[model samples]
Target: MNSSLTLRASAAALVLTAAMAPAVAAQPDDPAARSTIGVHARLLGEKIVPHKLSFQNTTVGGLSGVDRDPCSGEYVMISDDRSYLQPARFYTARIKVDAGGVHSVDFTGTHPFLQPDGSVYPPASAGDGKAVDPEELRVDPRTCRYWWAQEGDRPKSASEPVIQPSIQFADRSGAYRGQLRLPPQYEITMADRGIRRNKAVEAITFGAGSRVLTSAVEGPLIQDGPEPTVEHGALIRVTQQSRNGAVLGQFAYPLEKIFAESDPSSPWPPDTGVASILAFPGDPSRYLVLERTWVAGAGFKIRIYDATTRGATDVRRMDSLAGQRVVPMHKKLVADFADLGLSTVDNTEGMTWGPTLRNGERTLLLVSDDNFAEDEVTQIVALGIR
Candidate 1:
């Protein structure tokens, strides 16, 4: 849920202190520069964005994406409302941060995205193909225009129109600007031909200088394979394209095996996927990738991986990844949330580089999407990079 920049917060008395140690690495010789979010990381502090917070008629939750405007210094967050909670909109807010930690988050504005015809997007209940499931927001480093990712709809019963996912732009006031042309592979075709339902694009980012845009599919496509299971992990595609939509490259990203088994009797399916991605500052070839998973009884598992595309095969032409021999992106253990002592991880989905510390270190900021549930909270977690 990040693009332009990232946020950081604090206050151990009021927020959870995320004192996570470095996650265990597979390669014994893996250097931290290639393994963790930074050489060393520690808990800064955290604060909550009041549950069910409302802004301009929009429920300020389901915060799937966030990015700060370099010119304005204001952070923009996209809600995955699907036009249900308030016409598929976003919110602007100021999150105070420093060496001590994040002090406060004050939401300032809210705006709804306009359709090409100057209308608000309709809800999926209307069965229209225009409903949007906004996932991430990034400020166009060049134009300052809002670039966002929309994870399209997967028709539940064939009665609803299949909405192909897309990357689109909008002005600061939420006026429709334009959209990027997506590769054919992203089209919603069948159970084994294209993007999967609800498991399509979840994260997107503009590389340094806004030269390239990178996106991560939440899971394997129907043709790629099954979801990550306790027995083994899965493969998902990470696509890079020019702002105007020319395919630059596509790489395979191996997801980790499900960390825990779900309740055998639970009806809900276990889940695992990339929740957010941030391009390494000044380098598109490297990234800080976030992975989150949930089992029926085993809560949530979240981690940050220092990932690199160097030496990885560009699989843009590969038809399917199942049984393929291509080398995927290389990723190393970063930070695992299990090491943090928190009662509830709360469906954390967004990440960004936060304000720089007095020590010249950058703070890592995180936001959680409560999914508008009474039991959940809208949390903003801050960590220090040292």
Candidate 2:
């Protein structure tokens, strides 16, 4: 199911809460997990401030892969449809956060984007080794062009894998201009171990100025589940070339660096680096990596990491995301429609940084991936990064 699809009005809130439940619970706890920095909170110390922003979920189309425009302050989200699987299209919306900290998101329209042949680039029922799924999206800080990564299964030995990474450019009106194919350098690999594992890529962002960064959802292979633990998500840097549009260097986040303080035998794995990565504007060297973990049964934990120092801190973790929680302007509820409706999926796949709320206050935005289940409803949440 496409997460962007619409539902009946009465069922909308139910679906949204249920879909968000697992993702909200994925933020598991770690007794050893420590934090030196402090930030204010809501929901009896369960919620943060920036989430007060509101979004108008559209009924006309399915949307995913949301990103914030650095220059315009507008939010741009894309709906991935490879022919029948998903049509290659983009959505443009303007988000307004009030002085009192009230928030709202409006979906303006859908921009139809296609491949070279004018047909959808990634066709549904795509075979192995084919370019079909578009997983992660990012905006270039310098040129403002949009970049998306293809996440599909690794081609079998008998099937050939077309390892091509590409970027898309658009005009101010959100019109498609051109695309440049990125040359593949490094394939996804395990942290302590070295081998290409899970082929799914969850999120992408800009890092260290003009550089690009991304995280794989799971290893090239799945553990017992379809995804990896927060500890298994790996971060890597991508270098682009001025000529021939080549991807130069690929550096995976060293697992030892992330788990340096954790007990070696402890079952609580380090962050799998799922969710999304955000490189702060103005300061590129500093970035925030989000990891959502489901440690025991249903509770969740969300952590923020300082990429420059390779340090991390827990932000908010709760037993239920849909239950009433105090934000800023009002009391709010987080509901995961999926848990109550269909497949049990909790995924926060989108993240971006926007203009500051106050004079010196920084803003961070996050959206959950509903995976388009009948009971799931997608949500766009915001935060003020201090």
Candidate 3:
């Protein structure tokens, strides 16, 4: 199941306050160089639309992941439809970005993801016996092939079977090629161990020159520790693998306390997790991680953090993070979407580096999943980064 559909709303009063509050700028002084990265975001535009944005028979709303194709200067977006609405698929789009903001977005085409058997996924009612819940999408810089992550569904009962999560490779046309093997820790089972349901792999990116593929889990594994709470944070493992799927290394990433803007004391903890990641150009050890939290009544708390694995402990050989001393990656606040001065923010889950502007500064683009809700919207937000 897609996790964004489960987000609840927060109190109206608290939502208003959070929306209007001033954003605190991030400033981390560099000890050695005596200079800060000075990262900030200027809102280009927030394009919001109805849930039924369609292309022929398919609806283009459940956008879980997005990436830019430098070769074509177009963007590719993956929908987490689970073959229920249509065969599992992705779409190519052309978005016009200018000084004013995003002027328009046009869908060029949609391609169905083919299975190894050379058949598209059947509808959910068909009982096709295939487990696919596409969560993240990326373009393999080395081959221009499309790579996607699927958070395979967990067994609902003892009688049901478990489907392990996977990262799959496909051509631009979405033909099945091969898949990357995940470590045993990511396997799902009937026992109360391993990854929690709907909380497996959620984010993936190519590091620097595309030599390494990094993936992030949505939450900590059962043995890692408990889920994050208001008072305590949790650690999730970030794994790096070679383009051909050889495991290289793994490090710990600390997740901040759950963001419940409406009611921090609310009994139910809102869904908070890593939504997207973008590797720094020519730097495999550094990345920009996007964390999004949605409270029931209030709204979204979206933040970007600059993360580095330098000097971090490699937990690949470690059995568990609990009762063990480990050094997690260093993270610094980059920008808060709330501070970007947008009128409204939806479930922003997908992000990637856009084309550089005339001034040579980089741009970031984020897309939101409406979950096919009438009250919600599918939004594409552009930001100027420096």
Tens digits of per-residue lDDT, candidate 3, 64-86, equal 89999877889999998888888
Quote the lDDT for 173 in model 3.
93
Model 3 lDDT, full chain set: 0.77
Per-residue accuracy of model 2 over 1-386 as CA lDDT, tens digit each: 11211111231122112222211111112222223213332211011212212333323223446787776678777654444533555666777753344256666655545554554455545553345455556766787767665554444443455433345555544455676544332233323222133334555666556654433332322211122223222223222233235443332221111322345556764344445556555553344555544333332344444443222211122212223221100001122232322223344556676666555656555555444544334555555555
- Local accuracy of candidate 1 as per-residue lDDT tens digits, 5-43: 111122111111112111111222224324433445677
Give the TM-score comparing model 1 with the true structure, all chains together: 0.89
Q: Pick the candidate with the highest TM-score.
A: 1
The residue-level lDDT of candidate 2 at 52 comes to 19
- Better by lDDT, candidate 2 or 1: 1
- Each candidate structure's TM-score, on Cα atoms with residue i matched to residue i, is 0.89, 0.57, 0.87
Q: Give one clash count per candidate, in the order shown.
A: 5, 48, 6
What's the distance in Å from true for residue 319, model 3? 1.6
Task: Give candidate 3 misplaced runs (Cα > 4 Å).
Answer: 1-38, 123-128, 261-269
- Ranked by lDDT, the better of candidates 2 and 3 is 3
